[model samples]
Target: MTDRRPLVAGNWKMNGLSAAAAELDALAKALADRPAPACDVMIAPPFTLLAPFVAAASGTPIAIGGQDCSHLEPGAHTGDIAAVMLRDIGATSVIVGHSERRQDHHETDDLVRLKAEAAHEAGLVAIVCIGETEPERDRDQTLNVVTTQLAGSVPDAATADNTIIAYEPVWAIGTGRTPTAADVATVHGTIREVLVERFGEDIGNGLRILYGGSVKPANAGELMAVANVDGALVGGASLKAADFDGIIDAYR
Candidate 1:
């Protein structure tokens, strides 16, 4: 939270349609009169709306991203979009291996690794997600599961420039549940340790680690204040310009 630049990214998830474009424009216009906050902002809308959303966010501090990308650059992966394609469409980043994708699509860490590699290859920042389910948390195996996922999911080529880690408890995401500030600090600290050990001190400390799961403006400042909590990966609240803007203000 000190030297590390906070990044408040919105994961629009599967929501947002053409009309959602208005939210983007609204956000751009609303923030135009003010000085830029001491943080970064990004939004990952549904694939169908990336172009329009990016267009709407044009000239703003906001960066555009995709929810997911294919492991392969391009080929016969029907129904899948490649990282290159997303970049070609003006997306500067893409999320890979979110917990929902890991659960619904049975995406393995190896799969996530490949996808992250593809993102890096295409010059996109990969927000690689890692989290434990409710049962794992109940069993108090959160650190074990998180470390394992990080070890297996992050690409060897990953660096501060190309990768960001998000720690979202499965039980918390969209459930209005969240780990306490102390707990959040512990996990993020652990994740930071692993990152430094794997990627070296400079890159690891420089890499941003975001907290996700039911993040809202009301609780954002406290969460962002926690050690090692660089920012947030907002969910439902991100779909609304007002809510997302409020969350971004947490860094101020």
Candidate 2:
């Protein structure tokens, strides 16, 4: 991974409420007793909870991010959140092109790219997600699909400092099923190749590439150990402080 710092980010994903601040409190306490874990940590709570969660994690090492952001700047997009608004509330990063956004909302690659550009425009790191569906994986098109998404969804302005890539196979999300370590290595290796090729060695090799989908404490170590995998984008396991701490233990 060279000098790329690991980033373990929780994607709370349509989950959590103001009460969830307790979990951040607990997580903060857990980290307070130790030297910082050997990785970067962040959480993208629902929009409604961002401010509170940011407050809860204020003095801690954890960063607060948004789950999504609008491709357009502030305007009458109706229910859409601009990256600038998230930044205004102390969000340092934003997720773009998540599989759910791509599937449920039928977002095209161009739109995802625009959103990433928007994040950069607002001075936020864009965690861009890409992956193949179950059917595509079954047909052995994983590499091709990821390559295409990398080409289309990631913007030209992306740099190691402003972008992160997350690979989340749609079928495995929240299903308690995870790709084998070797499988993860293969996919991450492909992603790294595309990034290096497109952005050149310096920028690509410095960018962090994370794995998501079924990433619980039990499998976090194995997944993080995979080549080219700099960290994770955790889902269900991240909802609770204890479980999320356990996953963070992989770095500790």
Clashes of each: 0, 0
Please report, as a residue range, the 10-residue window in candidate 2 with the lowest summed lDDT: 28-37
* Alpha-carbon local distance difference test for all models: 0.91, 0.92
- Please provide TM-scores, in order, for all candidate models, with all chains considered together: 0.98, 0.98
Q: How much does candidate 2 score in TM-score?
A: 0.98
Most lDDT-accurate candidate: 2
| Root-mean-square deviation per candidate | 1.1, 0.8
* Model 1 lDDT per residue over 182-218, tens place: 9999999999999899999888898899999999989
**What is the RMSD of candidate 1?**
1.1
Model 2, residue 182: displacement in angstroms? 0.8
Clashing pairs in 2: none
